[model samples]
Target chain A: MSKDKWNDEEIGHWLKSVPKPEDNRSRDDILARLKADPRLRDKQPSRSRKWIPAGVAAAALLAAGILIPSLMDGGGEVSVSDSASESADDAAQTTSESFQSGRSIEQNSAASDEEMSLRSDQSVMEKGLMGAAVYPEAMEGFVPFRIGLVHEATVVPVTFLIPESVVAEDFGSVSPGDAELYNRYASQIDEEALGFDDYHPYQGTVSTDKGGVTLVLSGDHPYDTASASITTFAESVQETFRNEENVLVRDESGAPAEFDQVGALPEIATEPEGVYFAYEKNDGTTVLAPDRRFDPAHAAEAIELMKSRTTDLFEPLIPAEADLIVELPAEGDRMTIRFEEPFDFSRMDDQDAARMIDGIALTAAQYHLRVRLQNAVNPPAGYQLEDVLPLPAGPNGIILSLPG
Target chain B: MDESVFHRIYEEYHQDVYRFLIYLTKDRMLSEDLLHEVYVRVLKSFGNFQGKSSERTWLFSIARNVAFDHFRRSSVRRKRTDESFDWETEQPADRGLTPEEAAVHGDDMDRLFKVLDDCTEDQRMVLIMRFLQELSIAETAEVLGWTEAKVKTTQHRAVKKARELLEGMDGWGGGGR
Candidate 1:
């Protein structure tokens, strides 16, 4: 092995050994940066509009397009103009000249503009509805009174919708986001009255950034008693944050959260498990719950699994007298469940029926099936059950709009 | 473009492009900044994509252009003439000690990249796309807008240059595999 005569094949193999660098920033972070750039927006075609709210996008345009162009106009450390000045014989654009532009005039410090717009992107996100975490469209204009309710050992999430009118009373037109709402109302939520385990305003600091929520759990945070507790805590977080996809669980000192049994956990990815069933809170309040650990075989098996009481933890969503048959769609993805007797959801409480509908729809969703409930058409969550019901955006929704 | 479509493209290609930018710039913050530029340009001009090249190659082309633009804008132009850009991208940023650098300190790769720094821009691009990214010779040619022969020639020269540089250092002693 002569060092002097090392071959190309050896070099090629060693180059492959250079490990691919880790990219930690989430998709949301990149999107935030994209939304923050005005050049993209200025060139955006009209048909592609309205994905983001007009107000947020306008604010983004203002921050990126305005307020900082002159500040960076040749005023920064020398990266652009001074360096390229030495190159007197800069060649013609032989490659990708279509994307290229005049060096000096076009170099308006776009990189510096990026840092500015990223800081403003947070303000853009905070302007979105506080309850966008659960269902953005349905919960917009209402602040969330979210509580992580305990049902047996399961953490059942319940969000009370705080109407904008009520928010304006104290905060005056500027509705406080999750942190403020948590601070102001969390202590007062009667957990015993709500039938929860008194876990309100999580014993942690919840903050937001370009990459979704960062939950800083306290030293004695109570989320990690078991795998069930971990699942619920993490899932409950999904229901609580604006963007559930990127919840980073940090310790008190901001290191990635490490639980007692589970050695080290960096972040929580909230994915729906198999068939959801009914569970009752400590105060006998019923909520749709999923056995997050269980993996049901298929849609039919899930339907069967949902009917029988799994344990003291999970109860049957379907009534004991009700008998239903899972009817697979001929060509489409929607599963049809036809009921024989006691299938009338009209007899159940409106909210209970809603939860049942939600649970069934959610179970169907786990197997990539949309549910078209044949007999339960007029179930109480306000959507027409006669139609093919898509998966519920979430579970256990209860709005608490302040009275006028 | 639909945000969902943009998001899909971003998810699929963002990591590879980010790593490519990091290898080009060696500074995480600058890579991120350049990544932003790449994505912004991508989203703006995505409608123009003709689908002639694979989506991966298309993204790499855009990323290579973005890195080149950053060099043109930044002080990297001072090291060489317009035709030959001697990439002076030394000293990875302290903020993000990439897992690659942290895990492979004093390894062959550490020395390889150091030697690669002395290679020309064309050679660097060919070596990265061909070997690091595992793209074929034709795909690397598509990204750099060069003929396959040119890509092969550059790759050969780049590897030989890297070996020669490594041979000069006392400790290299010619690695076995």
Candidate 2:
């Protein structure tokens, strides 16, 4: 045996030091330990509303809304097709003309301010809550928290919720294949508040001299296309509006209403006052109630309060003791529960996965909490835990608010 | 065979399983724990054992996969925890050298581990079974579901790469092998 090599001797010495097996513990004990440790069960992806943009990007591409095709290839950077700029302008003009015609706006060059205001009000009334009327002032408040969006470029409805306060800034022709249009929309929203289950309010569309996209506002999910109305403006206005601060309150009719209220249901704590409450069963998967008027500066503080206050209500029924620290950038927390000295996931089939996902989802739903399926950030298998349901464009997970 | 066949097999071959793990990880306690795990696995799959490789070879192969899986999981956890745990530090040094000299020789092994870790599970399995487990080229081919010629060619490349690493060093073994 060579001294330098890791021959049988070195290995034998190391093996002798390991713990002796008792063979005493029953199978149930091992299973119990595993079940009690969330870390042991390969972590399913955490769900969040952040993925709405990506979903929207996919949806837009699928909807034939924009026909941008992949340009990059195996070679170096793709050269911009010279026809891109001219064709893009042409496409923008066509989309604008169609949208304007659909809304039946007059082609007159000189419309009175009163007429414009009356048309804006009429547009809001036509879509009802399906439209979010964003004014110029209301949009200014939410701009700082805006993150861009990713949506299916094809299916992305060209509609948006404009608080009555927003003023359009500039209306210029778009570069036909600019990928950032969706990205810009996604990045500009408060993702935590407007995730898979919540509405992601957008800043007004980049208007153009071709024909400006109109802002429709009343209080509701921004992706509610049926509620939006289009308009053409010779000059663009910067849209601004206040973010809805109250939870949604419903009238006797049971449709989601736009109003300021004390809270949602009487069972949970009261929804804060002065804020408008809008309750929605986001695409039939998650129920969320977001305040259209949130102040971004207070969001982190608000998140902490909500997390601590609702901890007990949303705790799991099986009561696991694994470390539950939310993952930070580089910190590592791991838990490994043994399975009778022979762990085999190959035996676990789809039925097992469904049962596990269902149990977790049902337990979460009890507290009115919706778990958004986030892909595994890292692990044994990097896989998406759940498919994002195809929704027109809305937040993806359960939305909740704190009591005043 | 009856369940007692598995119990008897475990009693007879548990040490060989432990020894196989020891060669792979070079950590005695970890190897023992893994050895026990292998036997437990064998106990579960005893009925499925079709006698393809001899009982000993089959047990060794299972032990190898388990050890490899453990290392992969450990390294992933370590990486996630410290974003900077260098896996090169875990390699063993070469013999026939003093402590300081061995450290220098250890660099080759470090690069070897890095290359091995980066390989796909299928490729890595073939490499380890041949060199580290000291399996014959044919034995490695059988265990990994590969042809004998493929195993030989891959092992030759693996050895050449290891020699290349050694050649890059000062006072190295050169490429005589």
Candidate 3:
């Protein structure tokens, strides 16, 4: 047997030489395995069912053949994908991709035919995510949050939905400090207020650079009209936000001490509604007001000043109106704002813009709606929100940047 | 091609796969379990395979990975490492000489196998796949993702080492040829 680069004759001989099993009993045994494991028959196109017969063919060859052929039973070099099963175990330790690569099924010594069959009968969903699923009903009683980053390290206000009958004491597991603060401010919360069902306090983080405050509502009512009462309450809160004074919830420690006031805009208007003052200083920036008693006139003035600013800096860089549209095709839950024009964000520094962008994002959380701000064209130079986000450009926008 | 085709494939390949596992892991039960697991996986992913390499080379590669993976997942490994043998627990040697292992037949072959065990896994694999498995140079190279030069060089070293081991054996390959 000369071996000179394995000619056609050698390959054919090699192919024909592999051993075939001597009995039909083994074939019957494997078929019984297939019958037992219904997963093999569950889907025909999948590799599981597809290769069973191929395996049987290889088995048949060995059972019937006289020669040992190659000590290895593999017919040829299997491609990576074909060999995926062999490496499935290794895949877990190697590349993340191969965990699902069940190309080869090793025979089991401890596995009973019954166990194999039962596994195949089980649905994939039954297996669950990493073996466990988060219960949906539990989510109902808990506050739903999509907590994420706000500017460098600050977190957006965490909104809480307080049930009408609940008092600060009913809040189980709430930190003692929070309990103390709630107790100190108990008088402000009207337990019997009619619109208390949807009462929520807009809670934001507080620190030297960033601090948090909560906009709370107080009231108490019976269990009878909870659902409808809650819905109406939510609407009333929104209406109050739009038409009343600019709410301010001040942290006990006050704003960050290091702010360098470049200039002070007059003391916030007496009847400020939508307008909230935010100051930037050397240490970091802080929002002037969070949730406070509503003032419609002051809000109108602040919103007017904010709307008049320009954003031409990074026009092309900003996501276009077509792209920025959230929950496309007219899904109703949205924070609708009519912009004067499309904003050009190109002018503002990227980092500052990201910061300013957080303001709009924070606003969105409060409203529980997706907000987008469009920028105006031919905007004034240096008329950008400093240390925050760039002005947005588009029709019907919600600007996140500070008033220029 | 058909059910019969698969039946033939399994019967033919199962033992070879088992043998490969046995040799690689040196654990009979682990090798059997992995052999079945490899076949099951092969059945599942067979359709995705494109005919780039021969099925045999592909199968061995699979067996190799399965064995390695089993090695990783087994908690038994920690026990093996922890349970060190005490030198005092040895049986007294028998006075008489024992016959050569019937499996190897020749003393030289037995020495060669011992030397094969002493070789690095990579060297052992190259030699086994080449001489024992009788894979072509190109085939072995493809299976291990090694260049042909590396496989040949390693094979040379392995055989040389085996010869060195053989020289110390009693028969010594018929009195050193």
Best by the lDDT measure: 1
Query: After superposing candidate 1, which stretches have Cα over 4 Å from the reference?
Result: A1-146, A167-185, A224-232, A297-301, A319-335, A339-355, A362-370, A375-385, A388-394, B1-177
DockQ of 1: 0.18
Clashing residue pairs for model 1: A79-B73, A79-B74, A80-B73, A160-A400, A161-A399, A161-A400
Candidates in order have lDDT scores of 0.56, 0.31, 0.34
Which 10-residue span in candidate 3 chain B carries the lowest summed lDDT?
A: B88-97
> How would the docking of model 2 be graded?
incorrect
Worst 10 residues of 2 chain A by lDDT: A227-236
DockQ of each: 0.18, 0.02, 0.01
Over the stretch A168-238, how does candidate 3's per-residue lDDT look in tens digits?
A: 24445653233233333322322111111112222332111122223332222211121212222222233
- lDDT for A153 in candidate 1 is 38
Cα miss at A351, model 1 (Å)? 7.7
- My TM-score estimates for the predictions, one after another, are 0.39, 0.28, 0.32
Query: Per-residue CA lDDT of candidate 1, range A86-125, in tens?
Result: 2111101111121242322123223332332222123222
Off by over 4 Å in 3: A1-27, A30-404, B1-5, B79-81, B84-113, B171-177
Give each model's clash number. 6, 110, 132
> Which digits, one per residue and each the tens of the lDDT, describe model 1 over residues B1-177?
258767887768877888787777665666776787677657756776799998888888878765654453233213212433323443323224566344434455466566656777777787788888889998999888889999988888887787877677634554444
Candidate 3 structure lDDT: 0.34
- Superposed by TM-score, candidate 1 places the C-alpha of residue A5 at a distance from the truth, in angstroms, of 73
